[model samples]
Structure formats: structure tokens, C-alpha cells
Target: MGVKSDIINFPVSSCLSPTDKSLEFDRDFRIRHYAGDVVYSVVGFIDKNKDTLFQDFKRLLYNSSNPVLKCMWPEGKLRINEVTKRPLTAATLFKNSMIMLVENLACKEPYYVRCIKPNEVKSPLLFEQERCRHQVEYLGLLENVRVRRAGFAYRQTYPRFLQRYLPHINHS
Candidate 1:
């Protein structure tokens, strides 16, 4: 085997829609395509030149402005993101998929990436109340606590890249 790239930086330039919206909450690992301007560096493939992990099912969020990458699980969607105008629900990116994964890296533990809007009071100002800052804070805390039990080392890293690239998802 060739020496793996010690470090790689991938810039997510685009994102995909979905082959079928209803298929979003169906499977843990779905096939996707990386149709974007930038590319990713994946490891342990027969053809590293064309290997990529971004073209797969990921966790879905309630509302998302920036793209949130997730690890599809047997259970229902288990991911979250900030509120956005497009209002992304339990859906997956099918076309224009722009995600990347780095080889051999460590990332933060998984936590209850929840929907901030759920905790808010229904009102005309709901837009201003997208994600409750406090809720996310607690989610972070709970994630740390779970990580402790799972023996996942606590590290400060961005959620997107870490989730996509980590060899193993550090469950919290």
C-alpha cells in the first residue's frame, strides 16, 4: 500500500439534494454523489484517485444553513443543524453533493444533535428563536459526558469534517 497522506484539507464546495425525498429516513448508508466544485481525500480504496466518502448517506438535520454531515444509523435520523430559510428536514443530499472526508483523523464525540426549534414557543417570532443557544449548550455537555463513558478522548474540532473523516464515531 502507498503511504497514506499524513494530512488532508477538504473544502466542501457544494451539496446534493436526494434521489427521492421519502427515501431519506429509510436507510443508514445510502449511495450519493459528490457533484461540486471541490473534492475530498478518502483513504483505503482500490483507487485513491477517485475514492470518496462524501457520496453516502449522512445524518439529517431539522433546519440547516451550512451543510451538516452525519453518520446514517439504523434508527431514525440522529443529527441536527442551525435553522435556515430552505428548511432542511429529515432529508439527504442527492445531487450537487459536496462533502469530503480526510483519512486517519480524530474528532469529537457524538451527542444529541437536537432541533432547537422544538424547544421554542410557537409564535410569529419563531425565526428569531431557531436554535435555543442553551439547548445546544446542554447537548454539548451531554455529549462530553457520554464520551467519557465511551472512552472517547475529548478534542476540539469542527463537527462537519470530524464526523465525515473519523475512523470511528466516538459515541457519547
Candidate 2:
């Protein structure tokens, strides 16, 4: 099979005239068209040339003094101002939160639970050898076994270890 070549055509200009009521001209003669959404940008609708539309949108959404926005979400407006004041990206916020979580976990006695999928078919007795091997390797069970065989895999001070394991055994 072979494809046929055909020329595609597009309109050279918009159908609406400058005097059309749908289009409005500001003091600077910048055209602002009224789409279904009341939101306006300095850039024209078709071209969307404004680079700072996101920032402008954010400002509109989080305008603390805007009566409609304040009425719609009082708490959101307050929080938005706090969030906008800080120059933090989503990645930075996520990294900071993860670091806090890790620090918190380090200070506490952590527990790990390992889960394995027995088989793809969901049969109780079906033990797939290859799948089990892959899971074991991925979970580092082999490394854990090697560490245990060599020596203590984990270390802690005698007093701290004793305190953790045997609460009744006073160090006095």
C-alpha cells in the first residue's frame, strides 16, 4: 500500500473583525477577547505569546484582596500567600519532606515488612521458582544472609542494646 499526497489549507486570518463586540480593546489597544472563562492574559488568544502566564495565573488565583477569591476560600487565600512568599519548587519541597522522614525514622526503632507475589495466576499452591528468585534477589535477602554469616550485621552500644531488649534489667 502507498499513501497519496494532498495539500492542507488553514485560514489566513480570524473571521471576527476588530469592531466585533466579542473582542475588546484596552487603553493600549491590546485586544482582549471574552472566552467562556473570564480569565484574561496580556497575550492574544491564538498566539499565546506571554511567557509569564503561569505566574500571572498564580497571582489571579491567589489574590488575597480579591473579594470573590477571599469569599470562596478564606483559608486557601491565607495559605496561598504563605506559599507564594517562599521561593520553593515542588522537587525541593519533596526532598525536604523525605529528609525529615528519614531523620525521624533514624531516631526510632524501625520495622520492615516484606511481601511477595506467589504466582501470576493467583493460585495458592503455584510457586514460580524464577519469580521467587527474582524477588529474593531484589529484596537483598542474599546480602542479609551473607552479612549474618560473616558477623553481626548491626551494632549498638552495650547500654543502649541492653536498654532496648531488656527493659527490666537495670544497668545499675
Candidate 3:
């Protein structure tokens, strides 16, 4: 017998301030991870920040520099873009990236999966009807059914539909 365990990993960025030798913006990083855990605790931090620690991380990638930031990224000697006037901070960039991802997902089809706990004591044979009903109601399955019956349950392109079923059909 094998035990099934779900592990969630969150990528946290920490920046060391050279002046005081203390972590900068540690609380904000922890808070962001906590909030993200609430939404995707089962999915394992799907929206982890890419490079959101030091102020000059993005600049280092682009080979740009600031006099103060140069100590942190010595090789990033290229001049910052003058047209933009101000570069986006790590927090702002993370927020914008999340917004863009949400917007993109909003334009695509969505799939939902529901997981239910069997019993309070983790008994395999126990099926509690009231608990199941409460789970269903909390998940809004009834509302989904009503809305789906009122409208098209699924919409697919003609070519996609043909591609899916053509192989299964006998072409007489």
C-alpha cells in the first residue's frame, strides 16, 4: 500500500539590504504567499512570483543600472531607458503580471473539479449524506446546472468537433 500525499510549494524571494544587513520587505513577501495559499493551496502556488525580490532584479536582467543598485548588480552597467522615466518596481510588476494572466484566462474556456472529504474521521466506507449535500451546495453545483440548462452547456468549433469524433465513426 502506498500513501498519497499532496505537497504545496511556494517560491519566496528575499533581498538582503547591504546597508543594515536585514531583509527588505519580508512581511510583504510573507503576506503575498499567505494570500496566494488561500486560493491555490491544493494547486501548489501556481501564481508564484518570478523575480520579485531585489529592486534591481529586473534591471539586472535587462542590463540596466542605478548608482545605488550597482552594488547589488555590479555587472548591470547599461543605462536605464530614458523614455519610460521610471521603471516598474518588483511588487508592481508581479501585480501587473497576475492581472494579465487573469485577463488572458478570462478569454478562455474554464474547467472545474470538485473534491469532497469522505468523513471527519477519514473513514473510507462512511458516506454522510448531509455533509455531501452541504459540499454540493457550497460548490454551487445546483446553480451551475440551472445556468447550464438555461444556456448551451458547451460550445466547440466545427473542426474541433469533427476532429474529436471522426476517428470514432466508421466512414462508410
Candidate 4:
């Protein structure tokens, strides 16, 4: 607070003027976003801003005897003192989980098969050879099969494959 010009709090913007004399928004602050400027009251979340609320929730859920919650909040296994200097936000946690899921699935070598309807009108017992053949030709299913057969080996993106299995190799 003693550092010169190191402002502790933002000053009320000159652009923000209250319409009613009875109302006062002294504690509120104006934030400039790409869409527009908006006023926010810091009164409610000031204390919450400093606390590791999500981390606490993760730890609480981790302590539960239920297997599902313990599985979801893996970081909860870490003691309160072991958490990083800044707690990771919910979005960060979600992103990390998604990355891991993608990496794990990439190792499975799943193939995409597009099922084409026999006809447009939902008629049963209809076999459209021309339509099915056209789809297979255009979708390069034949070429894919030829290449796969020629190679006769599992193929995956190297970086993702390495990242997925590296931990297992190191640990074992």
C-alpha cells in the first residue's frame, strides 16, 4: 500500500454516473470488456477472491468414501499445504481432463464408420447399391483399407501416443 502510484483499489470511473440521487455505487467498479463496460460490486466476492474455494471443494469431495467423487477430484489427495501457489480454476481442471481423455482415446485406434441410410424415405428392405458404393468410393474407404492392409500395423500420432504411455513406462 505504501508503494507510490501502486493503487490498492480502482477509482470510480468518471464515465459511470448514477441516475438516481438516492442510489450510491461507491463500492462498485466499472470493468471494460470487449462487448461493453459493466459495473460489478466487489463487496460479495472480495473475501472469496483470496480463498482457494474450488480446491477446498475438491479436497472435500476427495475425502468422501464414495469411489466416484474420489475418482473425479484426484488433486484432492494433495494436502492443503501442497497445492500450487495459485489454485487452478474450474476451467483449467476441465481442460486438463479433456486433454487426458483425448490422449487416452487416441491410443485405442478407433475407426470412424459413417452409416448411410438405404433410402431417403425410411423404407425398410431397401438396398441402394449405387448410393452405398458412391459413399464408400467418395469417403476413401477402399483406399484406407488398401493402405491399412499394406502397412499391417497400428498407427497413431507420435506425440499423443508417447504422452499417453510415457508415464506408465517411467513408473514401471
Per-residue C-alpha lDDT of model 2 across residues 1-172, encoded as one tens digit per residue: 2111110131223444566564443312233322112424333332232232233344555566777554433224344445454443333333444556667778987556767777889899899988878777777788888998998777677899878889767688
lDDT of each: 0.38, 0.51, 0.52, 0.66
* Candidate 2 deviant stretches above 4 angstroms: 1-88, 149-151, 154-158, 161-172
lDDT of 4 by residue, 1-172 (tens): 5211222343444633657443345556666542345766646443443444467788898999999778778998898788887787554465466666767897786777666666667688888888778767766778888988999656778898998888888463
The 10-residue segment of model 4 with minimum total lDDT is 2-11
The alpha-carbon deviation from the true structure for residue 103 of candidate 2, after best TM-score superposition, in angstroms, is 2.4
lDDT tens per residue, model 1, 1-172: 2222312233333333465443332122233322212333233332333332221233332223343322322121433343232432222232122222222123434554445544345665556433555554645756777888897864565787677678676677
lDDT ranking from best candidate downward: 4, 3, 2, 1
Expressed as tens digits, the lDDT of each residue in 11-91 for candidate 3 is: 445553456332234232222221132212222232353333443454565453445444434323444443244554444
Name the top lDDT candidate. 4
**TM of each candidate vs. truth:** 0.16, 0.37, 0.37, 0.33
List ranges where model 4 is wrong by over 4 Å: 1-53, 65-68, 109-172
Worst 10 residues of 2 by lDDT: 2-11
Model 3 TM: 0.37
Error of 4 at 49 (Å): 14
